[model samples]
Target chain A: EDQVTQSPEALRLQEGESSSLNCSYTVSGLRGLFWYRQDPGKGPEFLFTLYSAGEEKEKERLKATLTKKESFLHITAPKPEDSATYLCAVRRWDGSEKLVFGKGTKLTVNP
Target chain B: DVKVTQSSRYLVKRTGEKVFLECVQDMDHENMFWYRQDPGLGLRLIYFSYDVKMKEKGDIPEGYSVSREKKERFSLILESASTNQTSMYLCASIPRGLNEKLFFGSGTQLSVL
Candidate 1:
């Protein structure tokens, strides 16, 4: 079974505080890893796509890095508006074309 | 920007009633999907369509069916709504590749009473 697990189910950070969210996965063949930001009562918004290990992507205060077994989403000096649930998903090469997602890390940035 | 839209943001239906959740994407994506999210289970794929009239069963497709008459539209049908089926239904679209990122809609919160 392809499984994805995210750490720190709930996180609280003061404004300008930096933290990292973890996503660990076990799959047969990793096609891609994705990060999404979802607000309360809304759907997830696409953030980044990591294809291979050692790959990294950045957007504003958010930076994502991928490794062989896990991925990290680093939030630098986050603001209140950046508070949302961070979801990590992996798509395997099983031809199912389905993405297996983690439970997500709910971040609360207090300003 | 890629836009995925669902028919409703909130819906209330009784148990055993038939339900339909519609999703449409503005981008000409070849792949469209339907997922249900609960409080703890996260997001689980229910069904997906790779092409027009071509559908596939996802991880949790037991009580659901799908329709794809066009490239940009995918519909999810619940034959009989149940309390356990009350969840936030999400729709997504992606290009024709294994490594593509998905574009998601605002989601529909369905409450089964």
Candidate 2:
């Protein structure tokens, strides 16, 4: 079975603190890994997509890195506005477009 | 920018009543999805359509059905609303390809009484 698990269900970080959220997956054939940020009562916003190990993508203060077994979302000097639930999902290479998603990590960056 | 729009931001319906949730995308994408979000459960796929008149059931599709009569629009229907079915419904779209990012709408919060 294909499964995605995100650790540290909730994290409280002070403003300007840097941290990394983990997304671990077990699938047959890896196609792509995705990261998204969702605010309260809103749909998720796209962050990055990593297709292979050793790949990394960055946007503003967010950086996402991928590996064979896991992916990491690193937040650099996070601000209060950056607080949101980070979601991770994976697509398998079995010719299916369905994405299996994790439970997500609720991040609160306190000022 | 890719735009996926859900028709309602909030809805209130009574138990045993039928409900409809509408979603539309303007990027000419061939794939559209419906998901429900709840606390500690993240987002679970309910149904998806790859083309007009083609629908597939997702992880949780027991009490739900979908329609895709047109290329740009998808609708999720609840045959009989229940208290346990109250959730935040999300709609997303992606172009027909691999490794494409999904674009999502603002979402609709459905409350069942």
Candidate 3:
């Protein structure tokens, strides 16, 4: 069975706090991994895509790195505006078209 | 920027009433999807369409039906709305390729009473 797991269901950090959120997966074959940021009551916005191990992508204050079995979303000196639920989704290379998703990690940065 | 538009941001419906949710994408993407989200649970796919008049059932399709008569539009229908059906409905679109990023709409908050 293909599954995606995201750790730390919720996190609270003060402004300027740095942290990393984890996403691990078990699948037949890894096609790609996606990261999204979703604000309350709104649709998720695309963040990054990691296709292979040793690969990384960055935008603004967030950086995403990928490994063979997991991925990490690192936040640097986060601000209140960076607060949102971060979602992880994976695509299977074994002929499956749908993307499997993790429950997501709720992040709150207090100013 | 790729844009997926959901017709409603909020909706209120009575139990047993039929409901229709509409979504349209501006990008000429071949794939469109409908998903419902809730707290503690991530996005759950309800239905998807690959081409005109082509549809597929997703993970959670019970009590729901979909229509795709055009390439850019997809619709989700609830034959009989129920309280348990209340949720945030999201619409997304992607090109035919598997690695492409999904573009999403603002989503809809549906309340069934």
Candidate 4:
């Protein structure tokens, strides 16, 4: 079975603190890995998509790196406005276009 | 920017009542999906449509139905609402390719009493 797991269910950090969130997966083939940021009571916003191992993408203060078995979302000097739940989703080899998502890591960057 | 919009942000329905949640995407995406999100379960796919009038059952399609009357619109229907059915329903769309990233709506928070 294809599964995605996220570590550190919750993270609390002061403003300007930097950290990384992990997303590990077990699947036959990895089509793509997706990162999303979801605010409380709102839908998730698309962040980045990493297709191959050793691929990395960055947007503003967030950087995503991917490997064969895991992906990391690194936040640089996060602020309170950056506080939200970060989600990781994976597409498997089935071409079904369906995604298997992790439980998400709730991040709080207190200012 | 890709824009996905849902008909409602918050909804309250009673048990046994039929409910409808509508979603529209400005982007001409080939794939559209409906998902329900819970606290710990993350987002579970309920239904998806590849083209107009072409719908498929997703991972959790029981008690739910979907309609894709047009290329840019998708709707999710709850035949009979139940308390357990209360959840945050999200809609997303992606372009024609496999690697096209999904764009999501603001979501609808539904409460079944």
Identify the candidate with maximal DockQ.
2
How high is the CA lDDT of each candidate model? 0.93, 0.94, 0.92, 0.92
Regions of candidate 4 where Cα sits further than 4 Å from its true position: none
Please give, for residues B29-103, the per-residue lDDT of candidate 4 as tens digits.
889999999998889889999889989998899999999999999999999999999999999998766675788
Q: Could you arrange the candidates by TM-score from highest to lowest?
A: 2, 3, 1, 4
lDDT of candidate 1 over A27-86, digit per residue (tens):
998999999999999999889999999999999999999999999999999999999999
- Going through the candidates in order, their DockQ values are 0.73, 0.76, 0.67, 0.68
lDDT string, candidate 2, B23-102, tens digits: 99998988899999999998999999988999989999999999999999999999999999999999999887746778
Q: What is the iRMS for every candidate structure?
A: 1.4, 1.1, 1.6, 1.4
For candidate 1 chain B, the 10 contiguous residues with the lowest summed lDDT are B94-103
Q: B3-103, model 1: which lDDT tens digit per residue?
A: 99999999999999999999999989989999999987899999988889999888899989999998989999999999999999999988876467788
Better of 1 and 4 by DockQ: 1
Candidate 3 per-residue C-alpha lDDT over A11-65 given as tens digits, one digit per residue, 9 for 90 to 100: 9999999999999999888999999999998999999999899999999999999
For candidate 1, the chain B TM-score comes to: 0.96
Candidate 1: segments with Cα more than 4 A from true spot: none
Which 10 consecutive residues of model 2 chain A have the lowest summed lDDT? A91-100
Q: Which candidate is the best by lDDT?
A: 2
Worst 10 residues of 2 chain B by lDDT: B94-103
